[model samples]
Target: LGYPCRDLLRAWIHELDPDSRQRVVGRAVSAPRPPQLKKLAVLELCTREGSAQVVAQKLGVSRPTLYNWKNQLLG
Candidate 1:
């Protein structure tokens, strides 16, 4: 997964109930910063030719965030 998706997932997890959030936070705390979410999104967008809008919608983030990811990947 890519940074974009990981960020979105983190945001989603944060929105959950306290107990659920704690569980997720525990798992995430031990995880690396650039998690699979970033790689997955990059692969999905590059290899599968997915759209930024679709990815953003699914990830529940703005299109600008997706664009930032794309820019980061391209750079």
Candidate 2:
């Protein structure tokens, strides 16, 4: 695994109930972003909207950064 604990963490994130996911994203948006908060937006986009385009636009990340984060967290 690119990330040693990737599978476990992904599983846990995926398993979150709808309300929980929303709450997590809610907190994430208010937190710092760019690098530190990239994953939160990626997770939210993947689980809810499944849109990479929006991730780039919303998170102010470049295409490569968005794709890299997606591969890292959602591989």
Task: Judging by TM-score against the true structure, name the best candidate.
Answer: 1
Query: Each candidate: what lDDT?
Result: 0.63, 0.66
**TM-score of candidate 1 on Cα atoms, chains taken together:** 0.41
Q: What stretches of model 2 exceed 4 Å from their correct place?
A: 1-36
Writing each residue's lDDT as its tens digit, candidate 2 over 1-75 gives 366487777677777743454333443343335655766866766676656777677767666776777787778
lDDT (10s digit) by residue, model 1, range 1-75: 545677787877777743565333443233332646666666666665667778778765567765666677777
Q: Which run of 10 residues does model 2 get worst, by summed lDDT? A: 22-31
Which 10 consecutive positions of candidate 1 have the poorest summed lDDT? 24-33
Q: How many clashing residue pairs are found in candidate 2?
A: 0
TM-score of each: 0.41, 0.40
Off by over 4 Å in 1: 1-34, 48-50
Model 2 pairs whose backbones collide: none
